[model samples]
Target: MDEEYDVIVLGTGLKECILSGLLSVDGLKVLHMDRNDYYGGESTSLNLVQLWKKFRGSDKPPPQLGSSRDYNVDMIPKFMMANGTLVRVLIHTDVTKYLSFKAVDGSYVFNKGKIHKVPATDMEALKSPLMGIFEKRRARKFFIFVQDYDESDPRTHDGMDLTRVTTRQLIVKYGLDDNTVDFIGHALALHRDDHYLDEPALDTVKRMKLYAESLARFQGGSPYIYPLYGLGELPQAFARLSAVYGGTYMLNKPECKVEFDEEGKVCGVTSEGETARCKKVVCDPSYLPNKVRKVGKVARAICIMSHPIPNTNDSHSVQVILPQKQLGRRSDMYLFCCSYAHCVAPKGKFIAFVSTEAETDQPETELKPGIDLLGPIDEIFFDVYDRYEPVNEPSLDNCFISTSYDPTTHFESTVIDVLNMYNMITGKVVDLSVDLSAASAAEE
Candidate 1:
């Protein structure tokens, strides 16, 4: 217990576990400890009884809801983009060998009081009803431009530099309507709001291109993928990778106390009166509350349903993005659903989640737009949690803290958070440029 380590991770959340794995793979001595007995801290999947107990304050699940073992409900619902950063990480660390994945069935965006499939390719763009005929042609041209864009190829630049141009300018160049821009920015690019429109166009273009590439990866209905059981498998897979690289793990370590020297730099962490010495500490914000502050709040509804989300083309698994413009809200609402086909539920059962950044005191009213889209729900649970970000300087404290997960129902923003934390902890960007295309589980 007195042995020293290069880094000590203090949570079993997806972000912490990934950091532990990456650091261990970098040949650093690592020890990961969690206050809970479970592998995933806040991101663990719950069965029917556990879900009911957590939300309803009882262990009694409805008899009509089927067996408890048939439900693998993710506490923090998200889907992986087939060609996104998380997939690159999985392949870079060879973690896919420890888990299996299947393509999500559909992706749609809400616009102007109707739902429409998000057009990632030119053919889909031409056929999409979200835009008028002229707007569709403009959108297709934009998509073609993005698909052919090459940073190193001057000819593909089209007399415009995305690095300096605002996304608004790029969209105006193609004469796309405001509605078309809304879905492109908020849905396909997965931006939280319209703020990205005023930012540099390069990142937004890259995000849209990634979405198209991911959709093409599986040639499926959507660009996303989910694991066999649920998202809980992800942290465990990373834990195994960390273990294979000699990182030690402990769960149910009560009252994990981060010890600091007189100068306030971290020296070790103590649990059960046994202190494990370390040069630095990596942890989620929950481990060091004093160093973090609430940046925002997330309101979500976990819904158990007998059918898939209505108007989603009967997809067993799907995501629907309700853009803020369509709902007259400040932030978009996300709906995610997976059914028996995804193995996250029993036969004739579906699990869906409606989530968004809380913009008002009444979460139920705020989420009503998304909830109404589910048609009807069997049982529903509502949760609102504060999102925290570290305010302390990691260099001064030798403590790297991960931010709380956001309300978005995709891994793009989550992976960026992880990558930023990795850079801050290791002083180098985590290189994840592995060939993820070859690792896609898509079998045509």
Candidate 2:
């Protein structure tokens, strides 16, 4: 096997497959392989039998659960923001033609002890019950500042340069309370933690703008969207794109052993006694444990339900973020729900996931705040997996490794990881600027 490739991707995860597709479209020859027979490695959707087999092990699924083929439960649950980076990538690569998307119905945040719809726009801010009458006025002013904010428009700056101001300082400038700042920073801005308070306001403002723009795109109750079936559709769609661009894919290839050159750089990958020569390799952290370090742990609980999550306004699908401060924790907890409405489950069945960054050995205890919100569940399964990040620089070894998925319900953090890796590999940043007309066409 003397065939040489510009890049070799050793896993079928979403990140690797997306990279392969983008590189192939850029005219780089790519060889994509996965040890598993499926397209998604860590991020796959499983049917009832497969799902039960994975979690329950050897035990047969209950007959009352209906047809096994009717279920498509994602191992790692996450949704895409319609106008977010992932959607932009789909439109940029024309991958939307391979998939269908439905807007999520709700986005809620936990405050004190109740769930409230995140008020983003000024109108919502004015009517929001989360704040007192006086507080609503202050929040409305803050929302106005954010909505009118334009980096290039001095008229919209309001005498405070967001680039030079900390997010905490900007919040104080608007006279926002701690509770208002909590949801604004965690729910609307989608920050993982309150750590962004000390960071520049520019980042938080940009994130808030993205949420608003995405919400305006569909005029839906929420800013996020999910593909029909499940997230597993994403990797396969990208795989199709890579194939159309002349990239090769091999699945069920056993023992994918990576080879290193004398200079300690990736030279090729060996599988089934044949070596596929390539200049560089990209893969998930699992494929190269030695090159990765355990960063943290994610504890998640997957539940099957007969109805929508309580207090979500009966939304067919929803995302609920519980800010750390509300739960007296150091990180946010995510609640994601989808069901027959999204074609991922049987009729009248709903799937909900509660996940958070694990701080102790007890995951169920750590995620209790989120799980308590689900009134009743038919079946529930809990899982905890370690998170990993690469310790080596891609420029040094030519071996690029993707980090483990975080405990996020949205794709914003995931896409950021992908874009950073793309820049590292190509030595150029992928411009995220979108042409309004093009985005509209894709939506149509």
**Over the stretch 1-444, how does candidate 2's per-residue lDDT look in tens digits?**
469998999889889988998898889999999999998999999999988888889558999888888888998999888789988888788888888888889999999999999999999998888999999999988888899999999999899887789999998888899999999999999999888999889999999999998889888899988988898999999999999999998999998899999999999999889998989999999889899999999999999999999999999899999999999999999999999989899999999999999999999788889999999999999999999999997887999899999999998888889998888889977766755335453332
Clashes of each: 0, 0
Candidate 1 per-residue lDDT, tens place, 378-398, comes to: 999999999999999988999
Which stretches in model 2 have alpha-carbon errors above 4 Å?
A: 436-444
Off by over 4 Å in 1: 442-444
Query: Candidate 1: minimum summed lDDT over ten consecutive residues — where?
Result: 435-444
Clashes of 1: 0
Give the Å shift of residue 332 in candidate 2: 0.3
The estimated TM-scores of all candidates read 0.98, 0.98
Q: Indicate the residue-level lDDT of 92 in model 1.
A: 86
